[model samples]
Target: MASQSLAKIIANQQLNSKDYRLLISAPQIAKEAQVGQFLHLQCKEGIDPLLRRPFSIHDYDRQQGEVAILYRVLGKGTKQLLERRPGQEIDVLGPLGNGFDLTNTADKVVLVAGGIGVAPLVPLAKELIELDKEVAFLLGAANELELLCMGELEQLPLQLKVATIDGSLGHQGYVTELLEELLADSYGQVFACGPEAMLAAVQEITLKAGVEAQLSLEKRMGCGTGACLSCVCKVKVQQGSGFEYQRVCSEGPVFRADEVIFDE
Candidate 1:
């Protein structure tokens, strides 16, 4: 279920020049949200930026009735969001979109994240750890500066690996290259959230290795409830040979890696 409310901003802090973390008070939303779910946020009261912006739920505290969002200052909408201060009430509709499936009994799992895509996977990692699963994280960024959330993630019990395109980080290449080496091990399941190009590469690698994978996609959205059809993506039909459009906002922000058909 989803709800609309004026969530009070409890805390807001800048992680860097481009990224921020926002905490809000929304008990109903916090209680219902799952890993990979998102919130559609109205940045301002007026029609200046008419459409609401979509943000992935980075973390939530059900007991405290709080939810956190990690975002980058990408454009007008996010810039407006950056200006928001604690104690302000902002319009938000959330616990929207399907989340990653954690029902697998696999003992070993791998989570791959790139850039800010690491946001949604935090909760997923926490859940995996709670389930007593052996988890590993493979993170990638263009450079060391873009490797957001490293401090927060290090607090977890999972194995961590980092890669940067510039040789300034752990591995001097794409994270997918590191994934290729990790795939040689017998991982039960693989989950990823990143740029489409990275997801496509992960899909290829997982497909070749015959390992199951789920990918959380990021897309532009309007009505988070699936009425607008603005967040549709090409998906391979479950029972047929052809492809059809699926709403990323409702049907998924998460989908099987093999079923997503990326544009070439």
Candidate 2:
């Protein structure tokens, strides 16, 4: 990874009741970024949390020299991130992890995101649209209050489906429900990111339907550069006899559906 002090914070604002969005001035990273990639953010006070919080690169403006990260305030480290203000310099080590391989696209492309997991998928959707593919986004959240970037995602050049478990908004039930309905029609492949359980559910559904899929994993990572091996997960090799562990922070937060041995 190209290591350097990118930029300071331009804005850190709460996007919802449980989430916050941080806009950083990282021109270099933005200029070379792609969808499905993430950054290892160095929390202020010297990693007192003892790990760099990993977040998907939500959106980036190369022209403006900025990048955005959307995170849910579900833990102490995240809560600290929420307290960061404009002009404070935060160290970030990324544009790390492999992104979606949109090499093959069909007439229809489905992007599935769950909760804060929606962060990576948004950028993926933006790329698919630019490729002239018809895009449908399935977004899932626990309630209306937790639905992130609804307005922003709706503005994308694609069809957006919202699912809430509490039926507070959009289609009721899990995002998998919406995805199952859409897959009945024709779609080339599926791309997803979210809680492991949600991703596993998606994986099972897509695999059974004979559709190709890639899942972006959200794992706690230490030494985001892969030295710690803390983010490793078992992956099934194409022609190997057994599963081996791979670094989620480096090799992927993204992997092909059949390649991963989901945590049970």
Clash number for each model: 0, 0
Query: Candidate 1 versus the native: TM-score?
Result: 0.97
How high is the lDDT of residue 138 in model 2? 93
Candidate 1, residues 208-260, lDDT tens digits: the string is 99999999998888788888898999999889799999999989999999999
RMSD (Cα, Å) for all candidates, in order, is 1.3, 1.4
lDDT of 1 at 135: 89
State TM-scores per candidate.
Answer: 0.97, 0.96
Q: Write the per-residue lDDT of candidate 2 for residues 199-236, one digit (tens) a residue.
A: 99989999999999999997888888788898999998
Best by TM-score: 1
C-alpha lDDT of all candidate models, in order: 0.90, 0.87
Cα RMSD for predicted model 1: 1.3
